[model samples]
Target: MKYSLFTELKSREVIDLFRSVFSESEGEAEGQVISDFVSSLLATTKPQDLIGCIAEENERVVGCVFFSRFTVPSGQAAFILSPVAVSTEVQGSGIGKELIGYGLDHLRSQDVNLAFTYGDPTYYSKMGFKQISENIVNAPFPLSQPIGWLAQSLDGQEIQAMAGPTQCVDALNDPGLW
Candidate 1:
């Protein structure tokens, strides 16, 4: 398997991968929602504000994840991971973890201060994320699953308490998605 930057692949191909993966696991309707969300993220986010990675085998995309600029009250450079997908056939093969690790490393290299992601705690915990309280860093929207709001410092420092509300890219600002 090969890991590469999202910019190196076609947007349509990645979108289709998400649609197929999500459709198989989360049903067709959810697949479309995530597919459209990814489409918006790719089209609306500025190149510098977005970081994405993909996993490929034999030149075919098998997994993908995106991290878009996340605004925190502390004014530190940050990004949020969302809407990750791996082809159904490749699920549980560690491609998702590897893809995320690659993206996080890339963010660290670029001097990004923090990384946030909203997802299953057990799943993300394996990647070094810890449960973060809203009191420390408020999520942009009221989280439906607050326990899933997680973060980690890329520079090996503790995540300090941040005041005020957080902001995500417009594509990820929808309440329905929270």
Candidate 2:
């Protein structure tokens, strides 16, 4: 397996991978929702505001994840991970974890201070994320699954409580996604 920036692969390829993976896991209607969300993320977000990584095998994208610019009231550099997808055929191969690690490393190198993700805590905890309270750092929207609100400090410092609402890129600003 090879890992690289999401931009390294064709946009359609990444979109299709998400569609396929989500369709298998979450049914077709949800798959289309995620596909459209990814399309908006790619088309609407500024390059600097979006960071992505992909796992490829035999030159075909098999997994993908994205981190979009997140604005915190504290003014620290932050991004949120969302819409991760790994091909159904290779779900147990650890490709998703490695791809997320690659993206987080890229974020660290770029001096990103805080990384947040809304997902399964059990899975993301394996990636070093811990459940964060809204009282500590609020999410952009009211979470449907409050337990899934997770965060990690990329730097050595601990996460400090930030007040006020957070902001995500337009593509991720939708409440339905939260």
Candidate 3:
């Protein structure tokens, strides 16, 4: 049977479980930036903005995702989707999809309209995303992903004017990530 729950970042053991799952993600980068991003986000956001997923089988977390607030030029409300990972052994089990879907539903509940990420739309679009050109600035990643830049608007309204060079959010002001 499949099970999932939404929760906060939580303590060390959960973080460790998340890291193990992340090490298997497609862009697997030694999970160095992911750890830093988690720390930086924890320091930068309110207790409410950081969301995670605990996917379970026999009550053990085997997957997770991180969604936190980011200040777009509008300074209204937006979500930054980073670090979604499933256990290396459970890649085809759909855990990653459930995690992302939960995050999206939570954002919907909060009336959040936008979600941004630098990843393939093929995977993300399945979670209700599409390529967006309104990227005002580059992502904090070292590698450029012009085509990989995408956004998913929860309200069903397209964001044609949302493009611009992005500046780092105070919550994400880690100079290294940028």
Alpha-carbon RMSD to native, per candidate: 0.9, 0.9, 3.3
Q: Scored by CA lDDT, what does every candidate get?
A: 0.92, 0.92, 0.66
Each prediction's TM-score versus the true structure: 0.98, 0.98, 0.78
> In angstroms, how far off is 147's CA in candidate 1?
0.7
Candidate with more favorable, higher TM-score: 1 or 3: 1
Q: How high is the lDDT of residue 78 in model 1?
A: 96
Question: lDDT by residue for model 3 over 109-128, one digit each (tens)?
Answer: 88897888768778988887
Task: Give the distance in Å from residue 134's predicted Cα in candidate 2 to where it truly belongs.
Answer: 0.3
Candidate number of the best lDDT: 2
Q: In candidate 1, what are the lDDT values of residues 1-178, reduced to their tens digit?
A: 8998898356999999999998999899999999999999998988988888999898888999999999999999999999799999889989889999999999999999999999999999999899999999999998999999999999988899978888899899899999
Better of 1 and 3 by lDDT: 1
